[model samples]
Target chain A: MSFLLWLESTGFGTFVRESESLFAYPTFIVLHTFGLSIVVGISVVVGTRLMGLAPTIPLAPLNKLFPIMWFGFAINLFSGSGLAAAAASTTIPNPLFIAKIIFVLTAVAVMVVLQVKVFRDPEVDDKPLDTMSKALGGSLLALWLLAMISGRLITYIA
Target chain B: MNYSHIHIVLNHFPTIGTFFGLALFLYALWKKKQDMQIASFVTFMVMAVLVIPTFITGAAAEGAVSQRPGVNPALVALHQDAAIVAFTLLVLTGTFAWLALWQYRRFNAPSQWTVWTVMGLAIITMAMMMQTATLGGEISHPEIRAEGVAEVTAPPEGEEGIAYALQMWMVNNAWVWPTGETLHFTGMTLLFGVMFLVNFRLLGMLRGVPFSAIHRFLPLGILGFGVTMTSGVLMFNADFHRYVAVPTFFLKMFLVVVAGISVLYVTIFDDTWALGKGDGTALRHKIFAVTNTLLWLGAMYFGRMIPYLE
Candidate 1:
């Protein structure tokens, strides 16, 4: 509770909450929203391809999106921190917030697993995705979608 | 001249251009000439390209006419609303034309899906455009609203009463806004992800890969745009008054038009999709590519700032 209060009172937090400038809170929200889409949305597209949606799309070309996924993640990291800081007292103890964080972490883990086990392998590009690979893609997609929903619900439930 | 004059001059091109393209496309299909089909597809895209300027001038025409005597504001409003919907559909047809062109360039023929979808969308777009044009004519000419026909009364205000019922429902629902926010982001991801790849190809990063290969994902990008556009309309209708005087919204719309034209430029210009490339070789191509990138990025930024800025 004390830490929450301290965080809420910080300059960054106060600006995020109180600043009327377009560059502040609103920009953070926009960045966060676009970032969420790229990170999770790219994964969904890649996953869909793996699960046999638009098989004609080259699997190798999709690896180019990994850097973009990371870029989105970085944006989200900063914007998310700003968001949490702005309402630290409310957000810190909120069960939805906690669940959102957990989902985000798990989603990231699933993405990493898919990235390492499936996307990185050059041999898998020409061949059809094996059942296990398809399942991993499907799992990662579900995790990210759940994470997005949870994150969206945090403000309402909090 | 003024916007009204400009609007009058440009307005007929889209309608006429579409007919010309449709005629050729139909002829091509009847004759079973693949080359003519490709040519006709190009014509449809050219027609789409023409729509940008015409649609932009439409708002100006409305603004000009609103100030004049004997014009019914409600009728103008109806025309403006219909124009927005028609413009959206027409642009979608443009996107389909781009895919068709890309397919033709790469595979020696356009995809069957692209062919059928463009035909269907073109028909729909033509119907809507004709409706919008008629409404617009009613605003200025006043003859089309002759008392004998369907009532020429101004459309009633306040969500147009039940025409906007679904919009009202979404607005009233708490979950809708948040869901919209989440989906809006998802849409951005799909759009930007594919766009970034396309621009990089122009920048010469993805060598040896035909532009058509990346172009396959254009539909995905369009789908994303549709999601965001739908969400945006829902939110705007929820509280339209807040936006009437907002310069940012207008700026966003203007940039969207410019950004849209830039996309069409990238699509129709042969230099953009040429297979033998290591970065766009020509200075003009490079310029167009860079401009296209900046325009899209600018449009996105403006869209994001709509609620925040003006």
Candidate 2:
């Protein structure tokens, strides 16, 4: 925690903290949000599809969107971390803060699994997702929403 | 004077009112065994109806606030003007909600055309909401504050750096404010669309559907969160403390983090909730899902109130 605080107070942290330039800190934050939309948006769509909303839509092609989903996650990785660093650089331990970090780690892990199990075989064609697939989708959906709600809580709780 | 009063009433009323209405709707969705669906639908209708009074009273409040001392004439004007647009959007959103409910009853299950219409209206309503929210932010924060196209030009020299920085950022960023504002609005729709479905799923209103399939909508929710975070950061970069330090903003962030983590946990640890098993199988899953939705909603509502609280 002390090291985290020290890191936040460094010159880089100061830059994020004090920079008047719109591109510096604000850009990262904006990027972070965009990433959130892509990643979470994809999750919701795929998860719901797997659950059986748009049964007519093929599952395999929809899976193709996985790369973009991961890409969004990547954006969040870079931007969210930067914001966290900038934030932790100055302040003391924010417990709710720790919770957000933990959530991100979990979200990433689930996404990685999704990529491997679901989208790995590009040769696959459109078919209704199997029960296992639905389960995965349900779990994925639940994780994303939990992450989102918790993320929102950071604004108020801590 | 009238503008100020209108601003106060219009601003706070819709916000709190929306929360209540949404709460009722969610409650209805939850108790699916009962006539919760009908109750939820009714709650939404009432919410739509409330929009009218909220809009009118808001106008009166805005009239009262416009005359306050040290107020920027330009900002006051922008706030008033934007209110008309936002109010209009809210009315439209309410109407759409009513229509969507009507269609749901008529066709049973959301019809393709009805879904499209609701989606379109949601998008437009979101845009209007963003403009209204931006205007509301400007009423007090004034830092990097922009309403519509005109930049809130900086005050005379010797003005505080915070104010100057805000003005400079607002002026320098080309279309960032408007685009960011639009994205913010879109985020709300995404949040609502995905979340409501998730909520409905839990309550058994959407039982035939597998919870996993519902998971696909997670991306849309993410999209909304992304929009919010992006727009929020743009505003934050312009002025961080104004909102970040506020309790409302703080609480909102906390809820978001909770939602995010919970989603991740459920996804990876298949052990957490049995997938594809149908509803009522996993109490834990239901609790978490329901809790997550509520938190996200809370964050959004609180965020909408930042300006009013000040």
Candidate 3:
């Protein structure tokens, strides 16, 4: 509790919370939104393909998307940190916020599993996607939806 | 002149353009002229982009006209309802027309089923636009109203039927606004992702995939746009006063129109559609792609900044 309060009291945190400058709080929020759009948006697109929406799109080349998704994740990490630091005491203890974190983490894990078991397969383009990969894809989409819902709700419910 | 003047000037384009495009499309189909078909598709797409500004400015026009002593509020409401239906159908027709052109570029001919689908949607949309236009005329032009028609008594306060109830539900419920926001955010992500994939391909990434294959996913972007527009309308219906006065809101809307037109450009224009695996885009295509991407980003920025700017 003390650590969280201390984190919130830091100069950076104070600036994020109190500064009238658009660059301070709003920029972080905008970056967070852009990051969310990139990561979850790309994931959903790739995930839907794996779940059998557009089979003509070869799976192997989609491996190129992971780096972009990671770049988005990196943006989210920094922006999210700034946001959390600004209200550490309230956010850290909020169950909705905690759930959002877990949802995002689990979604990322599912993305990695798809990357390895699906995209990395040597015969991925030649063979039909296995049932396991399809299930993973479905789960990935569901997890991201939950993450988005929980993240949005935190603003209101918390 | 304000938005009302702008609305009147721009409003005739969608109805007239759709009728013109539909006639040309049918004539092309009869004559088997692919070039004419493409021209009609372009017409439909341009009308779609123009309709965004037309529909938005209608709200401003409503505010202006509804304040006049002789204007009937009930007539305005009825016209708005019809306009909503027409607006949605016109946009759908435009999308189908765009897909038809994209098909033509990819396969050397648009699919028979898609061609028929566009025709069906365009026909229905044309009818809706005519109905909306007539209702709008009746709002101020009593000369256009049917002779001896009964005066429309404004419904007692708080009794304007389903639209009023829905708006109240959105306002009265605690969860409604946040839920709309969540959906809006999700929709934005979906929209952004698809736009990124398509525009980046023009910007030279995703080279292994043919433009046609990525083109198949444009409907997903459209689906996202539909979700966002629906949720956005719900929010606006609930609290339009917050939006109407905000300069950032107007800027965001203007960017949406530009981004929308840019999407159509990449859809039908041969420069990007002809791109195959390992193909490099022209410099102009690259410039358009970058502009489209920035327009979307600007829209998102202005939309997010509305509260602060206000």
What DockQ does each prediction reach against the true complex?
0.36, 0.06, 0.71
- TM per model? 0.80, 0.43, 0.90
Q: Over the stretch A64-143, how does candidate 2's per-residue lDDT look in tens digits?
A: 56776778788988777677778773332666666666766776777677677775656433444567877877887677
Location of the lowest summed lDDT over 10 successive residues in candidate 1 chain B = B273-282
lDDT of 2 by residue, B1-310 (tens): 4434444555554445444545554465456422444343344344444444444444434444557764565565555455555555554445445444544433444455644454454455556555766666667665655444345643466553433455467658765565556566556657655665555555444444555555545555655655665566456545543653456665665566455445443332344323453445457656766787677666665665565444
Give a tens-digit lDDT track for model 3, residues B34-145. 8999999889987987887788788767877888887888888877777777888888888887778777766778898888888999999999999989988888888889
Model 2, runs deviating above 4 Å:
A89-93, A122-128, B1-310
Judge the docking of candidate 3 as incorrect, acceptable, medium or high: medium
Per-candidate iRMSD:
3.0, 10.0, 1.0
**Sorted on lDDT, highest at the top, how do the candidates line up?**
3, 1, 2
Error of 2 at A123 (Å): 6.9
Preferred candidate (lDDT higher): 1 or 2: 1
Predicted model with the maximum lDDT: 3
Alpha carbon RMSD to native, model 3: 2.7
The order of the candidates by TM-score, greatest first, is 3, 1, 2
Q: Select the stronger candidate by TM-score from 1 and 3.
A: 3
TM-score of chain B of each: 0.75, 0.43, 0.88
Better of 2 and 3 by DockQ: 3
